[model samples]
Target: MRSAAPAPRVIAVVGPTAAGKSDLGVFLAQQLGGEVVNADSMQLYRGMDIGTAKLTLGERGGVPHHLLDIWDVTEPANVATYQQLARAEIDRLLAQGRTPVLVGGSGLYVRGAIDVLEFPGTDPEVRARLEGELEEHGPGALHARLAAADPEAARAILPGNGRRIVRALEVIEITGRPFTANLPSHESVYDTVQIGVDVGRPELDERITVRVDRMWEAGLIDEVRALEERGLREGRTASRALGYQQILDAFAGECTEGEARAETVRATKRFARRQDSWFRRDPRVHWLSGAMEDRAELPRQALALVERAVTA
Candidate 1:
């Protein structure tokens, strides 16, 4: 058995989509006698299971996973709220003498949980006006405006994500500072160790394709349809989820179902690239291969890193 550290520390499993983060999180949590505090933003929404690649109850191996399926499909995701929830779970686990293992591709949510991040407050008038502009001219136009105001944030945010785009602009207007100003400079709120699962681009693309195909096979269309019946289409945040949005487009006759599937794969690949870029910028993450040959050893490697961190 590993010796206990001087104090409880938080462990984060991070990386691009389809890079085996969730499973690694489960393994680490089990090994460390920990519970998972989910950092995946989309997985917070109820009924987004299959598309978000949420682990099934059996697959979770009886390890407690906090913060999954907490939001309705119609409720917009708030990373600030998620930060609070995740920190509470992490604190609770640590108080119980168990580790807190954080897991997800959602970089901001992960950072918000472990880092000293203070999100800027919103302004109703500014938000309503920007959202009105978004509704009239679409995200593309506001993205262009954001590009002029905060080129770095614009580059980080996808142009098609109108909700985030609006939020970015709103924060800028309210604070008279760049929206990216809200982020911390890798300042940890806890004694934290970040383990990044590194999967190569080619393999990650292949994995994304296979995952999307499997999603279709596993009834993604049916899932989207059911969520639609529950107001997914009107949801500003949930409706824009990678696969869900594509399926929504197909349902609206904007594209063929097959085309939507294809687009989902392509879009997911792009998103994975962005996730990689985001995490790569953080100096704290220690990356371990999630490649096929290295897969069996990842758990050991991650544990070793944690051991080193704890023993240091």
Candidate 2:
């Protein structure tokens, strides 16, 4: 009797922003006859295309992509919800004998999709009080409090990220533990092969600068303006997105457009370093060079790696 073939493992293309993750994801999906499930948190929002560097339909090489633009700008990001949605898609793809390529640089979103993670319930009263504090004292003050409570969480989250700071505080209050303490250890829910796109810091910084420049050139400001009409400012998560936040500052006369552009470059570069640090901590990822000279070989190397994992 012939044994049934094992199901295809989920493939995650991950790394810092502008590290060629999207393009590599598309290539792997095309080669493996798979669909893409977005793991980029910002790319989940509608009308956040240019800043998120979302791949155009044409750029996707006729491959089916899932979970991109699934959320309204007004909706707060829920990793638990995203985990449910991503697993459903991955299960469906595997059932149909196709591969599922999970793609993005949002570390938590990626982990939520494939990791054995559980989120604590929110307490409305606690949340409200923390939110009030955030509004009154600002993110910096709350961040200092978080630093005292969970310096690890504070280090992971940006001080200016009021929404996350509030969430961390809320979680701490609800769980009676540090927010980082609530995170599960390295255990995966799915048989996932993470491919980390590796690029040198200097090169990655340059890539980010160019990518941000292209976003501005490609009418990112116009996109932000359009989304602003749809209550972007009221959308806590959307308004705090890296490029969008800087642009919002410019819109409010907080800075000149040129200053916003330069700041975006600087901020993105810093973020890329953090991203690199996050992925490097995971031992399971198979690192692949994303240099322009190595572009042609990446898909082949990635496929070979996946095949090895499948066979082993």
Candidate 3:
């Protein structure tokens, strides 16, 4: 009898926003005969196009990408679901003799996939209660409550992230276990080679500003208006998107268009800063910095590191 071949490993291309992760994924996929598996939470929702900076078919450069826009806006897409789906797809790709490259700025999603985090399953009753509390007490108040309940989890999650904070608290409330308690004990699912791209703070800030401005000009407000017209208002997943929220405020006469643009820029910058902070804490990632260096050389260096990791 023939022995089963080993499972294919993963190559994770993770970094902050505007770090050319998507472009690099495409380039590497083509170079290494691989498929790209998305790890971004926002990009998983259909019709959240502009705000998420989701890749278009053309932008994919004919490379196969998976797990993007595979869910409805109303459905909850959590890390557990992502890990299951991503692993399945990676297996399929390997069966077809292709590498799988995970690409995104979502720190939690990437870590969840690689680390095999085990989140508590959802309970409809508990979820409804959490949703009600979100409506009545507000996300901030509920987040504070979670902070008191699970300080470590609260510290790990962003306080401003209503969806995650609420979900974390709901898991604790429903399962009678802390959110962190459900996670696996430092065991990684994949033998991954992590390539983290970095740029100078000033350069990254400039890139963010430019990207936000381009997005605004690309009818991001129009997209937000369309989503709102479709009844995706505040408290909905679609509305919580960075650019969408700012534009929604403008649509409600809460801010001027210019004010909305500025807010979007500022929020994106802050998000990128948080991403940088999160990735830096991981010593496993090999950091690449400096915009003055050749951009194409970045992927080459990453590929070399990954190839070495796989062989070693």
Q: How well does each candidate superpose onto the true structure, as a TM-score?
A: 0.97, 0.95, 0.90
Q: 26-118, model 1: which lDDT tens digit per residue?
A: 888888898888888999999999999999999998899999999999998898899888988988988898989999999999989999889
Q: In candidate 3, what are the lDDT values of residues 66-185, reduced to their tens digit?
A: 998787666655677788898888779877878888999888788887886767778888888887888888778988999899998888788778788888888898888888887555
Task: Flag clash pairs in model 3.
Answer: none
| Worst window of 10 by summed lDDT in candidate 2 | 1-10
Poorest stretch of ten by lDDT in candidate 1? 1-10
The TM-score of candidate 3 is: 0.90
TM-score of 1: 0.97
Query: What lDDT is reached at residue 46 by model 1?
Result: 94
TM-score of 2: 0.95
On lDDT, the candidate that comes out on top is 1
Answer with 1 or 2, whichever has the higher lDDT. 1
| True-vs-predicted CA distance for residue 126, candidate 2, Å | 0.4
lDDT of 2 by residue, 155-240 (tens): 99999888889999999888889999877668988888899999999888889889999999999999999999999988979988
